[model samples]
Target: MGEARYSRQIPLIGEEGQERLGRSSVAVVGLGGIGSPLSLLVAAAGVGRIRLVDWDLVELSNLNRQILYTSRDLMRPKPFVAAERISLLNPRVEVEVVHEPLVPGNADSIVEGVDLVLDALDSLEARLALGDACQRAGAPHTYAAVQGLFGLVTLIVPGETPCLRCILPERPREEPAFTVGPVPALVASVSASEAIRILSGRGPSLAGRMLVVDLSSPSFEFIELSGECPHRPPEPPPRPAYFRRGDRLYAFEADPSGWERLERRGWAVVEESDAYVRLSGPGSVAVFYSDGGALLVGSRGEGDFREAVGGDLEDL
Candidate 1:
């Protein structure tokens, strides 16, 4: 509730870091094995708000490893039950429950404002969709998976660390796998710790690497990872001058000095580097290149471009 609630950890991470947790928000998608403990740990660490996303109901089978539920909570919505347990543990953390799976339709909105989204999902397809959304929105994602006595955890920082699709281009079979309570418990602990580290301004431990845990052999392995992210919105037919390619919806022919022109109008330059210059305004995260091309990734970004140019977007 106050400094006293986090006093023990404050000495370890300092008051500034503790306050950082209180100001940050995170979403834990999936309320099963890993999500249960991970969400609790984050809340106990004083994370300000947590969004619980899962579409499953409590089942007796899930009680074996899902620490958040018991026989009494059977058949209840996982998110709502998780929220109640979270409230009992720490009333200060605001909890929001979503009774839906993460898919392309809702992925973008799910990642909108959260500082981080931790993946406890058991579905590979959903994981990829979430990864795509997080990468596009520039949000941090922590991924964890458990099978049998083994599991892995990694932190994906958009534009930095490789996205999930980059690491796994092909979806693996979704065959049933075996898992024990200890395996998921350990993995979720690490997953929560990683989330806390990022929220508290200490950054992530698995930024460019993946931690592979095998409780069977009592081995903790760190595997290095490097790859270019290949997730991008699908291209559609160009509407006159606007073209879609890779991660950008852009205008092929633009004024190299157009940023200044837009700046004179209203757009503000947010980032500039050797590759391109970025502009921020009402409806786009746009970038301009030396070759007079404008890259936009937002929904109405093309409209913004058309208005800024003071003309219709026509063929180059």
Candidate 2:
């Protein structure tokens, strides 16, 4: 508890809080602009074990905002250089490097045994996957992104609060992001601070609130995000009842293959052609076609198909 490294903030968080921070393990999933400062801050705060995850290499262009690398480190793998820098900042913190891309097949392994997961990824797909992985692992997740001079940060607590997917239903095509130095630094620090609070048991956690910042105006906006995780495997579309070919139509009574369904249903055959097949039920005329679409013109008391095809009058 006599660590002078955290002396200035020790008064606020206390020795016990510092001990908690020193015992927590956190995984940062991206090592770009946001993850750079975020990992640095978390390590500097003495987070016990830090996992630096990224698949890209450092480039001269990244020097604009990614503070962990220098021009001398160009073309070098990011996670290694990041690990080196973080170690220099605080050797007491244990650092682990994941040098591969985060894919669905390996996301679970990356989050394994971590107390918290931070989302600093640029791609929408990776962000969603990380969120789901954290949810499944029951790890607290912090997500943040920066564009131009604006940035946003949110805290996601697995099944307890709205996840990243709940807020974004579709994955957007990855596009080049426009950002300056200060925006991502601000967002990253905010995310790191939130992680610290949550890990130190000193949080009025941003569990359901998103902090949005517009540094151009030096303004901060708080958005309350609430809901359950709405992510589920999409259901397959239902098979069609009938289909049309040219001006002819065909219907299926059972199996869509050939006309076996109609034969099984005992419907009278009205006509048959290479393009269309027609069937006659007691009071209805059914048309089926090779294209797999079907149409039925039936009586008033029939099934919902009557209303589905715009009712009986239109059928006439």
- lDDT of residue 218 for candidate 2: 92
**Model 2 poorest ten-residue lDDT run:** 242-251
lDDT of 2 by residue, 1-316 (tens): 8578999878888889899999999999999999999999999998999999875656677999999888986645577778889989999999987755565556778889988898899878667777777777777888898888889999988778887788777766676888899999999999999988977879746888999999889999899987677765233224333332222222233222434455465667666655346566655555454444344544434444444333342222
Instruction: List runs of model 1 lying over 4 Å from the truth.
Output: 233-316
TM-score of each: 0.73, 0.72
Q: Supply the global lDDT for candidate 1.
A: 0.77
lDDT of 1 by residue, 1-316 (tens): 2367887898878888988998999999998998898888998999999999975557687988999998987645577789989999999899987655566667787777889999998878778878888877889898899998999999999888888887787878886657989988898999988887888888788998999998878999999988766667442222233444223345444666666766676778876755456676666555555555554444554556567555554421
lDDT of each: 0.77, 0.74
In terms of TM-score, how similar is model 2 to the real structure? 0.72
